[model samples]
Target chain A: MGGLAVIEVVALDGDDTLWHSEQMFVDTQARFRDLLAPHVDLDHAALDARLLEVERRNLSTLGYGVKAFTLSLIETAIEVTEGRVLGRDVQAIVDLGKALLDHPVQLLDGVPEAVDALTGRYRVMIITKGDLLHQESKVARSGLAEDLWAVEIVSEKDAPTYERVLRRHRIDPASFVMVGNSVRSDVLPVLALGGRAVHVPYHVTWELEQPDHDPADGDFPVLAGLTHLPACLEAMGAEAA
Target chain B: MGGLAVIEVVALDGDDTLWHSEQMFVDTQARFRDLLAPHVDLDHAALDARLLEVERRNLSTLGYGVKAFTLSLIETAIEVTEGRVLGRDVQAIVDLGKALLDHPVQLLDGVPEAVDALTGRYRVMIITKGDLLHQESKVARSGLAEDLWAVEIVSEKDAPTYERVLRRHRIDPASFVMVGNSVRSDVLPVLALGGRAVHVPYHVTWELEQPDHDPADGDFPVLAGLTHLPACLEAMGAEAA
Candidate 1:
């Protein structure tokens, strides 16, 4: 197969890759800061510090997800307030976290356009990692659901998990392309399996999505964002055929 | 590729596939019964009922492993004995459960020979799922580590996971074959991915390994045990090629 024929499937990553996720998290954190201000006299920085500390300590014990994050916030609020946090304040904080679940998923700039450009030309899939229910909820609410051929919400994006997705879809690794922000979860593993990947950096990345600095050999391309994705796909497609 | 030239990678599942894992568990349960007889004053049927209850209740919280099983035994003993269980007896029962981990792994009759016969001719991989530390430890201690091309100890062996393994090894799904005791975890997923699978029954299977039955499509063969694995691989190779 030559350049154009080499690539058939284009796997797009969700969360911070295609949407403004971390910014939403920041928004949520700000609300948390406001809710606890009266009781704690703490600023956003101090609240964020306490939340991070609680989150770090509870990682293994609580695992990951909004539920855990919300609980951490409540725990931090109670601690900072010296057990004097009001019930209404606590309820408001909890409601803000829950509200995130229903928030309109904002697609990153040019994402919908890029996805549209690749729609008929390539098989497009949403390959993301998060809590199943939460991730699925995001997909449904995103308004880009119809643009994807399939949506894969996995617990992790390791080599084994990526392989499973490809196999399930019956797409050959040589013919598939993974497009995401994270160097670690998105790019490296897909490249390791002889699959192609395009890195589209997000403004702010969650720590888990950071790429591995040291990687096995492969000329994986890095794009500025979704705006640059179509051209990369065109180049790979031409090279593959 | 032509019908006869299509390559296949036949993955042989260790543990319960070509061995007597469940029997060992049953034996351990019997020992537990014997140990708790004096203090519990429960009949064999009653003891079995209590053990099953403990297993069901702890499935999500504790997961599957020797440690969980041992803990269940201790908890059950305490529950049945109603605080009458002696310290010495408790210690002995715990020790009995702990011994299971260190017990010499005994592959079923004809397993090693079957693997040996196929090793030289096929891309055979050992794919089993469990706690990473415990599973790897068992594989290393089993003395079968030297005979295979690769060993995949996974948390789950769904179709996607198997596909990833093949991709990592640079093999085609059409050329891969999965042999194991599970229909849910092994057989079905491979078939879903356009790969072949062979089912080899084990006497006692962990509850998690039990798969619901579906009508066979002739994509893969189901066999009795490891005794038939060599012939199955040869037949699949000839058919694929």
Candidate 2:
């Protein structure tokens, strides 16, 4: 057991961790590239970089969400095409945003079993960040609502944000473990606050969510997938015991 | 004082309640009308009506806030203009949304005084509903952050939402009071839950926020302005005492 603290609560990130989400963004970005193909001679990679630039510029004003992404796409189209982009194409981008919002909630393999396994033994909750209404709707549609202790949809997942959430819920960081797909968001912040974190990498990550340095730079356990989460936590529990 | 419940907490609705917000929406609506005039022969009133229709239709999908408003505006332009609206016009609507986001948070007259008057006598907090990041940023800019005990930015202000917030914070409905500008959001929900509410009408209200019928249909005190809030609460306190 050494000096390790026993984990009492397990908190997981919503997007990409429990469900297929980043893949939708990837598909939408592809659709965006296709829509611009006729108006611009640039490669897909170059166009994506330009849209990313617009997103970065608008981030402070628009924050984060499908709406922000859609706005950036429209702006990028307008800029790259030099106003030659037709209004119908602009409308297509808006439809893309709508489709993303109305996308069905698809749970990843082993998600329900992992949550069920952890439910009785530990306080399981979801701590996700994004557009509030959109996230709330997704949680409602996820069918995991009745099994969790609490659900917090924050605007960001920084160290201070994590600290505030933990304090508000009266959960000690020493006994808290955050499992998610983004190391920059769900992993690093929790670890910085003296908490435990498990990384479950998704197949495709949003460029903005990627960490500049190698995620392996951090001292945390990495799981092959969510199916491996329960066993990993149990081993840690044994060590603490 | 017989049977009257003593108020222990004072919660306020942000936006048009503590600051000028609806007027900005009104002004933006005017600009939207102007942008469409060249492409369509419809009068301002008809154009405004069409835009409202689009907003109502998109509410469930887009929820609320500047982003939602902007999306609706873009969609309306495309529909009414019959594909004649230029990309530049769509870009103009996006700029309008950005301006709304960047608009200075102007505290209504005597707001600071009213909040200050209520501060030490009771636990003061803000219960605002809108985009999470946008609402949070507005709070930070409002200069009233230090005076509030807590701030809740929710997606909607329905009865269930109020109940969840009150129960989570361990606040008794009998001892709570909500003050705001929207009768539908700030008044009806609290009153339905046996909590008291005070309505302080703003000069301009968003059509969506307006109640279906007369707001006086409900049983609650109505103040002429925020400056009178402290005195009204004190009288309620005396009655309960």
Candidate 3:
């Protein structure tokens, strides 16, 4: 709310905030419903319930992924139908699940341009969570790779990691601005560690990124999205000047 | 694949892997299209493109969340209508957006059960990311709070934080097992810190949670979900004994 300082560093969160990662699963789930609609008289709710049960039972055995979900859908159909599910129905579900895995990753709106704007002024870094190979592949394919100063695909965004990152970048926490959708991960830790943080709410957030602790104070500011970030930084830069 | 040890701890990630957090946006967009279909000839793709453009422009300005996304949807609708949008249409969209904020938080199947099972044998912790208030509320409402020994709703989940959590809990890293859907957050860091990790994949993961780094040989074990976690611990317990 006060006069801004030109942000020297801008760190962003990936996932629902930056791109269309989670929606793909929803679309695929819908596709799964459509695939099995003819063979079973189940509504989306019923189908979903059955699939969820199977998924629950197999969570540790199958883990998470489109393939597992799809396979579970097939298994659920067979179970709900008492093993009378048509072969075509089973096969269709499997094929659709495979198709989901192969679907191209789609970036959310404004991401590229916002990255461009921020990169022009601030050292941009991606502080995200996930598998090592998977997150990196997304960054490389996201079309914003060249614009970033560094991409820290981390396991978590806690204080220690943020400190390590700051030490690695040799940037003062005061000059750095953490920007992302998850307030718990991207903003809170940065602010807690004496870094400036700007929260850009994403369209979707994974449940894990949900915060578990109360904020100490008004250390972090929440914004509408990335569009207003550059202007904020410019204003901050002006104030600093 | 090595013989399991007595499981002393379990950790989890929040986000698409857990529940219906991300789909709300997609559903809202779909609802928006349905609302505007009668007045305008705009299809889902056209409307999505416009909204995407607005979102891109507002990323830095607005940040992320249903509030900004809903506003963007309304703005896009108005743009498509050339500023002649009806009052009812505007109110409907606004209501739809507001409705999303009130949507009940839903947990993925097997989560509570998995937590319950693990709780009987091991100390459970939830090391998720998000706004403190929001995430804590979810934990309180999840019905699994009673099962956990501690919850580290962190802004980040990296090696140092993991070490800190272990120290705080007074548990040996070698005796603990981090179970989560994210490879980056739940598995890799714990394993990197010389702790055992079990990966349970979620249906969808935030882009940040995708693994970008290569595993350093036998860094962790991947499981289907928490259902098998008890057995893993039992095997480990036997081996230790």
**Best of the candidates, TM-score:** 2
Model 1 segments more than 4 A misplaced: A1-5, A41-43, A60-63, A215-219, A239-241, B1-241
Write candidate 2's Cα lDDT for A1-241 as tens digits.
Answer: 1245889999999999998898999899999999999999999889989999999899889988888888888899989998888888999999999999999999999999989888978999999988889999999999999989999998889999999899989988888999999989989888888888998999888888987655555678888788999999998778777
A1-241 per-residue lDDT for model 1 (tens digits): 2232467789988878887777787888888887777667777777788888887875543444554465566667767876666545654655565566557788888888888998978888899864445666688777888978888766567898898788867888888889888888888888888788888877777654455577445678888889888888888777766
Q: Which has the greatest lDDT?
A: 2
* DockQ category of candidate 3: incorrect
> How would you encode candidate 3's per-residue C-alpha lDDT over B51-103 as one tens digit per residue?
88877764433334454455467567767876555545655665675466556
Question: Candidate 2, DockQ to 2 decimals?
Answer: 0.80
Chain B TM-score for the candidates in order: 0.84, 0.96, 0.68
Better of 2 and 3 by DockQ: 2
lDDT score for residue B55 of model 1: 73
Tens digits of lDDT, candidate 2, B114-174: 9999997899999998888899999999999998888999999999999999998999898
Give the CAPRI rating of model 2. Answer: high
Q: After superposing candidate 2, which stretches have Cα over 4 Å from the reference? A: A1-4, A214-217, B1-4, B214-217
Worst 10 residues of 3 chain B by lDDT: B59-68
Candidate 1 lDDT, tens digit per residue, B145-179? 78777777654577677777777678777777788
